[model samples]
Target: MIAIQNLTKQFGATTAVKNLSLAVNPGETFGLIGPDGAGKTTTLRVIATAMRPTTGQVTVAGIDVTHDPEAVKKTIGYMPQRFALYPDLSVLENLNFFADVFGSPRAQRTELIARLLGFARLGEFQTRLARNLSGGMQKKLALAATLMHRPRLLLLDEPTTGVDPVSRREFWDLLTQVHLDGVTIVISTPYLDEAERCQRVGLMYRGELIACDDPRQLRANLGAVVFEAHSTRALQARKLIEHRAGVRVASAHGDQLRLLLDCAERAAEIQTFFHANAISVDDWRQVQPRLEDAFVLMIAQEKQP
Candidate 1:
């Protein structure tokens, strides 16, 4: 439902996005992830028709953004990283205003608004002013306003960033519902956990796309052996194994540390280091790589200027 080819965006001497290209299938939630200043928003803005690309082309549902930006705007609902609703307006009033902007058919307003209110659990708060709502409720109101138009594609830029955990879950549920309703969605987020929920994720680094694939597939491609090591002196264990032969990476996960070791040459070395340190390595068997591990590994390998 969406196609981008060698898309590039720049400002002055710095490039915000560098020839980024990807596709989003209908009903799929494609996530773009990176740290701050990685150009996720710049890319999203291009797709949202809020900004023009420096080069290349973007076709959303067959409408060329460069040639038919207005058409692309009509077919895509864009929710920016910031709240876009009128704070003084009542929840229902905010939705009504956006519905008007989208020129939603009179016959469709009540039904669509009602369903979104239910999906966002804002039905009872319709009459309340948006400013009076809790942080989570306000976010829901913003999402409801964006959905009132029922655009075929959703370009959400970190819809759940500041939301509480419960609110985040609610937001994800709403996204799942939208996918079920056949809406193509592209979202940019910094949260790795959110990336795990996506059908496929593109990892961006320093304005360049480093990896793009299903989270599971990316992890599968790591092709490294993982083990959970727990010890009272966790820091000591980490230090001992970090530069030790056979260990490529180590990250602390709660009380346990995940170790990525070279199974062929250094598995024995890893075991020896752990045993000598008196750290209990339970579940010592090789385990699957994770998306976070894959991202960290990918970012660490980036060539520096």
Candidate 2:
């Protein structure tokens, strides 16, 4: 439902997005994954028509974003990283205002508002001011406002960021409901677990899409074996193998040192290295590759000369 080709966006001497291209199919959940300054937000802004691209083409449902942004806006809902809601306005008031802004028909506004209040689970708190609501409630209210026009596609920029774990789970449940309603979703998130939930994920780094695929395929493509070492000195163990040959990536996960090796044979060598260093590994076992592992590996590879 969305298409971008050779899209580039720049700010003076700096380029936020460079020669990027992507597509989101109808009814699909596409996740944009990256660290800060990875240009995910800039790409979303271009698709949302919030800003004009420096060059290249962007279209929503076949309408060129540059040629007719207004028409494209009509078919998509964009929830920016920091959505603007009238804090002084009550939940119902905020919804009403956005409905008016989107030009919802007077005849349908009441029923729409009522349904949304229920959908967002703000029916009882509809009279509460947005500033008074909990963080999670505020997010839901923002999402409800974004849905006022019933756009065909939803563009969410880290919608769950800063929310508590329970609230984050609740928000994803709401997104699942939206997806079931046949709305295509393009969401940007820093959390790899969130990206795993998408039908496809695009990894952005240095203003370019370095990898894109389903979570399973991406993990498999890492072509590395992961092993976990439990030791009293996890950090020291990580330091020993982090720069060692055949060790693709080494990181500390809680009390364990998680290592991605070039081959299973490297596991025995890593154990011997830890033994020789007197790091005293208490346990060792192979672990499944994770999307985060693949992401780190890919970004590390990209940084190589």
Candidate 3:
């Protein structure tokens, strides 16, 4: 339930965000995908009413963020990229503190606190100090504290950054449960796999939104034939094809190299080209397009502009 139109934010001569327009529907999870310094956090802050945009309009839960900041804050929950919990506070104490800030009644605090702890999987660590928790647990604590008020809209900025794979999976599970409960979420993350989990993704770069669609839609729009190559020289293959004609893109994925060919070419053509050059490819095959491939293509185009 958020609408951002022509959003622009500037600091001195450098604009962190420019002419950005975004709409996040209620009951849906919209992801903001970008690298560091892409203005994802600045945009989030504008929507959260924590920072004012140089020029733009932001509305949360149908309330204008600038015109009714207090109302917007009251209806939305915010979990920043950086941890915002008191280092010395115990898990239970942190929740209680936020509940009080949200004016959660003393009678309702116990139940809400219990649910928050369980959802965050911090039930056993309720007595542990925040600073003593692991990276994942610290993020969960921040999320739990943000939810202490039961806000209708959840704004999470890289909720799983720096988390181990297992913890990241667990965090996504928690988010899905929260979404089922009718809370709309808007999240920004650098992880492409994480972007796949979103209902839709907004690809951002250089202070602008380049693309917005579901991961499937993004893949379909690429219109490029893809091939996967497995070889020890995958990086070398990537470098060889980086500027090669017929091959629009080449990137290394683990031990394999994923390549993109123009619509006029075929996988057989790519193999033939590499074979003629003595690239010594071990294995190659056509494969379905992935979000990572699409993101890479998008960023590459942005650089050209």
Predicted structure with the largest lDDT when compared to the true one: 2
How does each model score on TM-score?
Answer: 0.89, 0.98, 0.95
Across 1-305, the per-residue lDDT of candidate 1 in tens digits comes to 89999999999898999988888888888999988999999999999989999999999999999999988988988999996778889988988888888888999788988988898898999999888988888877777788776789999998888879988888888888888998988998877889999999999987889999998888888866777766566666787777665667877766677787767556667767678867766545556677878887777668433
Model 1 clash pairs are none
Candidate that scores best on TM-score: 2
Weakest 10 consecutive residues, lDDT, candidate 2?
274-283
lDDT of 2: 0.93
**Model 2 TM-score on a 0 to 1 scale:** 0.98
Best-to-worst TM-score order = 2, 3, 1
How close to the true structure is residue 136 of candidate 1, measured as C-alpha lDDT? Answer: 80
- Residue 217 lDDT, candidate 3, scale 0-100: 96
Clashing pairs for predicted structure model 3, backbone only: none
Compute the lDDT of residue 281 as modeled in candidate 1: 60
Q: Judge candidate 3 against the unseen true structure and give its global Cα lDDT, from 0 to 1.
A: 0.88
